[model samples]
Target: MRLLTVSALLLLLLGPGLALQIQCYQCEEMTHDCATPEFIVNCTVNVQDMCQKEVLVKDDGIHYRKSCASSGACLIASSGYQQFCTGKLNSVCITCCNTPLCNGPRQKKRPPASGAAAPNAPRVGLLPLPLLPLLLLSSTLC
Candidate 1:
């Protein structure tokens, strides 16, 4: 298939040791406010290429966590709200990306009752035009 051919070519072009890796700030704690992390370290993601920054909300308060995620994770963070546990539980936000070390700083804030993300929610732009084809080829191989 043409897809297979392109994938093979791209794989060969990438050479060895070019596996996708996502670096993220891995931490979790329950607090009214998440402390601004001073330094970010690499998160070990064996099979997943995506990174995630999530804020889980419950009756107690905010719980912040960040780490790697599977590829099925959205290319961008969703501003929509998802509630569970009889509406007592909520996810303030779940931001995802494929770039290495893309999960940047996170600060805790109460989830809006209206389910809208904060005005400053992170947004990841699409790949450049020239690079898009290469990424597509690489994905086919994988």
Candidate 2:
């Protein structure tokens, strides 16, 4: 019991001095659509800080941000921007971490169908090219 109390007291005394050193990626890379990150840089974080990975999707393009931020900022980053960015943004994802160099790029999540169309998205038209030629030939024969 005495040892437990002593240990707890020591922890209380030393806990305030113990701070974590975090490493994260720092860069702002933009893409027409959400794609793999193309650039990465090393950044050091402050004590009790967190690494932030954010995705900002707009009608024009998608942007990826990785940097160091405080825990409080991480919690309110999204909510704080909701008012002004509500309808402008298609999708937004902000992830926070504390480990060293843990802010590696991740696959960006695309917005719903209301967002930009995919590169290879199938075209929708009156008829298929082959069938259109066949129909034209059949009409000419008739």
Task: Please provide, for model 1 over 1-142, each residue's C-alpha lDDT reduced to its tens digit, 9 standing for 90 to 100.
Answer: 7777886776577645465446656666645333346435555545667777667777787677766767665433443433331324664677787776666554377767787767799977876455567876677667
In model 2, what lDDT does residue 110 have? 66
Top model number, lDDT: 2
11-91 per-residue lDDT for model 2 (tens digits):
576555454466666776646322234433334334337777777777777777777777888768856655554435676
Provide the RMSD of all predictions against the true structure, rounded to 1 decimal.
10.1, 24.2
- Whole-model lDDT, candidate 1? 0.61
lDDT of 2 at 97: 78
RMSD, candidate 2, Å = 24.2
**Candidate 1 regions off by >4 Å?**
1-14, 30-39, 44-46, 73-92, 106-142
Clashing residue pair totals per candidate (backbone < 3 A): 0, 0
